[model samples]
Target: GRGQAPATGQAPPPEGNLRARLTSFVGREEDIRVIGDDLARARLVTLLGAGGAGKTRLSQEAAEAHARVGGGWPDGVWFVGLAPVDDAEDVAQAALAAVGARDTKLRGAAAEELRVLAELTSDSDPLHRLVEHCGRRRMLIVLDNCEHLVDAAARLAEELLARCPGVQVLATSREPLGVPGELLRPVEPLPPEPALQLFADRGAAARPGFRVEDDLPAATEICRRLDGLPLAIELAAARLRLLSPRQIADRLDDRFRLLTSGSRTVLPRQQTLRAVVDWSWDLLDEGERTVLRRLSVFAGGCALAAAEAVCADGRLDALDVDALLGSLVDKSLVVAAPGDLGADGMRYRLLETVAEYAAERLAEAGDDKEATERRHLTYYRELARTTEPRLRGRGQRAADRLLSTEHENLHTALRRALAAGEVGELLCLVHALSWYWQLHDLRAESRHWSGAVAALGPDPFA
Candidate 1:
C-alpha cells in the first residue's frame, strides 16, 4: 500500500489532505473574501503575519472558500508543509511529495543536467520537474510555514509562476516570500465582535454551557488584554474549565507562562502560546535575536531613536539598529507603524507575548536587565523633561499629541522610578507629565503619584 501511485483512474485523494483541523474555525470572513479575490488574479498570494496571528488557519479557510466557489483552480489544491524542513534543498522534494508528482526520472535528468550545465544549474533540482509535472493543470497549492525556507520558497513560487501559468500559490509565512509579483495579505487579530464569538465558541468546548454574555465586560476585557490574537484567545478560553474570564485577564501580565497550556490535538508548538513563539524565535540570526532582547525594555513601542538608545550594547550596535529592526520587522517579530515617536518615519513594537519572551531571554543571557531598564527610563525621562517646556504656549497641541503617543512608556518609566525608590527621579517625571496628565484628564493618576512623592519625607533635591 505504501509505494503505490493511485490507480490510473483514481481522483488523487481530494486535494492532497489539507489536514483535517479538529478545531472549529471562526471569524476572518473579510480575510477569506479578500484573499479569494487575490488568488483569482495573482499566481502567488502570501498571508503574512506574526506566528499565532492565524496566517495558516486563515489561509486554509481562504483556500477552502476559493475551492467552494470554483475560483478556477481545477487541477486540485495541494499543501506543502515547511515546518518539518530544515535545509532549503529539501523544499522541492517536500513539494513534489505533496503533489504526488513522481520525481525519479526528473531526478536523474537533474543529475545529468548538472554535469552538462555545471555553471548554470543546481544539483538535484526539483522545481523544474514540478513545473513540468503541473504544466497542463490549473491548480491551487498552499505553501504552509515558509519562513524558515523563505528563499527556497520564493524561488519555487517565482519559477512556478513564470513557468506553470496554470498554477496558483497561496502561501502562509511570518514574512513575504520576496519573489516578484507576490501579493501579501497581512493577517491581523480578530476584531472585538468576532473575537468574542470565537472566545464563546471555544469556551463552550472547554466547559459546556459556558456563556460569554453573562459577564460581557469581563469577557471583553479578557479579549482586549490578549490583543484579540486568536491563538492566545483560544488558549485562554481552554482554561475556562478551571479559571474565570476575570482570572484569565488578571494573569495575562505574565501570559508567556499563563497561556502555555493549549489543546493537545494541535502541533506541539501550537500546544502552547510560548511554544508557537519559540518556533519563530529559533529562526532568527544572532543580530536579530540580540536586538529583539534589548527592544523588550519598551512597553508600548519605541521610535528608532529610542530603540537605538536602549538596544545598542556590546552585542548590538547603534549604527546597525535600523537594519536589525528592519530584519526583525521582516520576520514579523517586530511590528512597524507610522507614528509620532521620532523623525525616523516609523515606530516599531514586539507583540506583548514576544516582548515577554525576549525579556526572559535577556535575563537568561546574563544581560543587565537593570541597566537596560535604567537606559530606557533615562531616555524617556529626558524626553519628558525636554518636551515639558514645549508643551506650553504655541506648541501645546503637537507636544500633547507626542506625549499621548508615548503615554505607556512614560507610565512605565514612572513605575520604574517608584520601584527603584528614586525620589528625585519620580518628582521630575511627575512634574514633567503634570500637564500631560491634566491635558488627558488623568488628574486622579497625577494626584496619586504626587501623593506618593509627598510621602517621601523630603525632596531629595532640596
Candidate 2:
C-alpha cells in the first residue's frame, strides 16, 4: 500500500503560501523555457550538468515562471535546497520541515515520536501530498544540489512521481537520477554572444563607464577562453572592478594562476570558479587527497587498473583505489567517463584546475621530486615496455590507457630527469612511451624527448 500520511489526527499544517520570487536570472532563457515547458506539462525533469553550470538558477527561474503562469501549481511552488544536508534520511526530514510540517503533535518516546513524525510527515511530504493536493491543480517542486544526496533524492522523487500525478518536479544535479519519467535537460555553457553580453552588462553595472571597445575583442577572447561558463566569466568581470580589461585578459592568459581571485560578497565556494572547486577538494579526507595528488599525473582520463598501478604505493594498497576513487567522484573532484579499455570498464579525468592544484601540492610537500619522478618514470617505463610487444594484442588497450593517463606527468618527469642529468631513466621512459606517442599522434613529443635523451654525453646507466 502507498505510505500512510501523518497520524497526527490534526489537519496538515498550513502551506507557506510564500510566492516564489526570482532574485535574478541571466543568460539561460532557452534553459528556462525548456524547463518551464516541462513544469507546465507536469513532467518530472532533471537538469544535468557540471558544477557551476547554473542549474540552481535555471531551476529557480522555472519555478518563478510557473508561479507567474496563473498559479501553475495550486499547492504553490516549493523549493528544498539539499546542499547543506549530508545524511540521506535527514534529507527527507529537512524537506518536510522546510515545507512546514509541524512536530508539536508528534509525541511519545523519542523513537516512537520520530516514527509518528515520519508517518505524519510522510503523508504530508509535500511531494506525496502534492498529488492529491494537485487533483487537476498544478504545482512545482524544486530540489537543488541533489548530487550529494542522490539516493535520498531519487527515492523521494520516485515516491512523489508515483503518488503525485499532477505535480512537476524540477531537480538540479551534476548527473542524472536513472528513474522512469525522468527527462534530462543537459545544460551547456553560455554561447559566445550572450556570454559577452552578460560580461559587458555585469561590468557596466559594477563600474558605470566600463566600455567594451578594443577591449571588447579582448573581453570576447577572455569569455571564449573560459569556455563561456557563466561563473568563470562573472569572476573575470569581477576582477575588472579593480583591474583593466586588458590586465584581466593578460592575467587570464594563465587561467590556472589568475583565476584565484574570488568575489567579496558571494559564498567562498561561489567566489571564483577555482574556489568552488576547492570547496569540494577541501571536504576530502587525507586518503582521498593523497589519491587525488597522485592521480593528477594523468592528463587524460584513466581506467581503475592504471590508477591502481600509478597511485598505489606502500601506504595505499592496490585494493583501496576503487573506494578512494568512488569517494573522489562523490566529492566531485574526479569525474568518471566511458573508456575504451575493456576490462577496466570505466575511466576518470581530473579537471585542469584540479590537476594544477594537485600538482602544486605535490611539489610543495618537499618530497624528493626526483625520487617521485623516478618511481613515476619507472612505473610507466615498465608499463610501456611490457605493453609494447603486444601492440595489436589485448594488452595494447591497457598499455595505451596507462600511457594516455600518465602523459603529462610523464612529460614533467622526463623534463625533470633531463634537467637533473638522470639520462638513463629519461631514455627508458621515452622508449616505453613510444607506442603511446605513436598511437595518440604525439610523435612530436616523442621526437623532442628522444632528442633530449640523445643530448646526454653518455647513458647514465653505463
Top of the candidates by lDDT: 1
TM-score of predicted structure 2: 0.67
lDDT of 1: 0.81
What overall lDDT, based on C-alpha atoms, would model 2 receive against the true structure?
Answer: 0.67
TM-score of each: 0.86, 0.67
RMSD of each: 7.2, 9.2
True-vs-predicted CA distance for residue 223, candidate 1, Å: 1.8
Clashes of 1: 0
**Can you list the residue pairs that collide in candidate 2?**
5-123, 6-120, 73-138, 73-139, 134-137
* Candidate lDDT values, in order: 0.81, 0.67
Q: What digit string (tens of lDDT, one per residue) describes model 1 on residues 270-314?
A: 888889888888988888888888888898898888999988877
Error of 2 at 13 (Å): 25
Candidate 1 similarity to native, TM-score: 0.86
Residues 264-337, candidate 2: write the lDDT tens digits.
75566676676666655666678888888877666566667768877777788878977898877755567777
